[model samples]
Target: RFGDKFIRVSFSIPTPEVERFVDAFPKVMAEL
Candidate 1:
């Protein structure tokens, strides 16, 4: 899904909405 460099950059500080979206993403993905 992500390259090494992308993975490294992905962990930078996330906004509150981003954090909430990330929290729900796994559940959404699992349902699909």
Candidate 2:
């Protein structure tokens, strides 16, 4: 899923952004 790409990028992003991304990750994975 596209979530994989986001996961890969999430680590390279800033902490705040990664936190937000992590927060949303569960919902995204659930949707998949």
Best model number under TM-score: 2
Please write out the lDDT profile of model 2 over residues 1-32, one tens digit for every residue: 87698778977899998898789978988999
lDDT of 1 at 25: 72
User: For model 2, what is the error of residue 32's alpha carbon versus the real structure, in angstroms, after optimal superposition?
Assistant: 0.7
In model 1, the clashing pairs are none
Worst 10 residues of 1 by lDDT: 1-10
Candidates in order have lDDT scores of 0.68, 0.86
Query: Clash totals for all models, in order?
Result: 0, 0
Candidate 1 has what TM-score? 0.56
**Model 1 Cα lDDT, one tens digit per residue, 1-31:** 4557545555664677567767897898899
- Clashing pairs for model 2 are none
TM-score of 2: 0.63
RMSD of 2: 2.9
lDDT, candidate 2, equals 0.86
